[model samples]
Target: MKDTFSSAAAARQAAQSEMQKVDRGAATLSQALGLGRPHLMPQAAVTVEGFKPEIDSEDWLVKSVEHTLGDGGFTTHIELERQGDGNARDQEDVEDLVNDPKK
Candidate 1:
């Protein structure tokens, strides 16, 4: 009975140690990724045009950038612009500018 209890205690200790290591690794990764810790992560703080749909799209873009850049190397900035109506050429010009890689 004594041996059994000691063995169980040792196993528990080992498990706890491993868990601590995993937690540390997670924290390191989170820091490297430019993300705040779980409870205090930084938010984008942007004004979305279409709240529901736009938020989803923004989330997707962020995730994609995260995947592509590994961690803390990516950021997204959203700007709201108001262009007057009856401006087809202006709209097309803006669209082309957005599509172009070097604008």
Candidate 2:
């Protein structure tokens, strides 16, 4: 995709923002919910609680919410993703570009 921003800074910011979105969307995560999270919704930010593993506790950007009712009663599921280091160099590039557009 491509766009024409009104200014150089706007173009830089748009590129940076797109990179961030790609970073966050690089992985798909799913969490089965027990209770106490009925309010979870798509596009919300969530953090792991209940002393999960450090990696499991990283903040997530909510992608979707699912609810199911079966013989076991009701259950909720959350599909999430997180910003990743997949674009570390891209980040540095954005920084360098912002700091020195001539680069």
Candidate 3:
């Protein structure tokens, strides 16, 4: 026996496949930028359930949206600026501190 499905279902499946392909391309681009993997990117964070960042200004949200949709998906910052302020904790540093016997 043969199975049959509606054209709409086929179209939906095709669209989903195309979207996955695009997401793969985006992930590849993201990794090439020294941004680690796509899952580590800002957009991935935004996808997490219960993840909501409360920026004080609409300007910040607009800037964020722009970055997510724009090439590189991030603002062009120099090495120094990208490192951020000295007072901010680095994830690696925190992990090292937690695991170190000396700490």
Candidate 4:
């Protein structure tokens, strides 16, 4: 029983070491690919006109629209931006409000 426990502990340590190496390699790869840093958000000055929102709110704005055509069919991607000085918490609140029917 003691030998089995020792072997399990050894295996765990080896797995953890391998994972650390993998993480280091991934970071190096990201740096090489010019993806080491977080992507910048769109500037506040950017705006879209004639945007119609289902919810009557002024906090959210349309950021961009992407159209794609492929064998599957046509698809549209609409990215929305929340206007505020607050952080992620504020964004989450706005998302909740937009999704809430009782709003």
Q: Give the TM-score of candidate 4.
A: 0.24
Runs with alpha carbons beyond 4 Å of true place in candidate 3: 1-6, 29-103
> What's the number of clashes in each of the models?
0, 0, 0, 0
- TM-score between candidate 3 and the true structure: 0.23
Q: For model 4, how does the per-residue alpha-carbon lDDT over 4-40 read when each residue is reduced to its tens digit? A: 2234446444444444343332211001112221232
Candidate lDDT (C-alpha), each: 0.31, 0.71, 0.29, 0.37
Better of 2 and 3 by lDDT: 2
lDDT of 3 by residue, 1-103 (tens): 0223255445434444444443333221111223323333232221212223422111110111212325655442211001112223344543443344243
Model 3 lDDT, residue 53, Cα = 44
TM-scores of the models, in the given order? 0.23, 0.70, 0.23, 0.24
Which has the higher lDDT value, candidate number 1 or candidate number 3?
Answer: 1
Pairwise lDDT winner, candidates 1 and 4: 4
lDDT per residue for candidate 1 within 1-103, as digits (tens), equals 1122234446444444444343332211111224422222233222233445633333211111122233554443222222112232354444443344244
Q: What value does the lDDT take at residue 84 in candidate 3? A: 16
Query: Judged by lDDT against the true structure, how good is candidate 3?
Result: 0.29
Local distance difference test, candidate 4: 0.37
The digit string of per-residue lDDT tens for model 2 on 53-78 reads: 86466768889898878776788998
* lDDT for residue 67 in candidate 3, whole number 0-100: 20
Give the runs in model 1 whose Cα sits over 4 Å from its true position: 1-6, 29-103
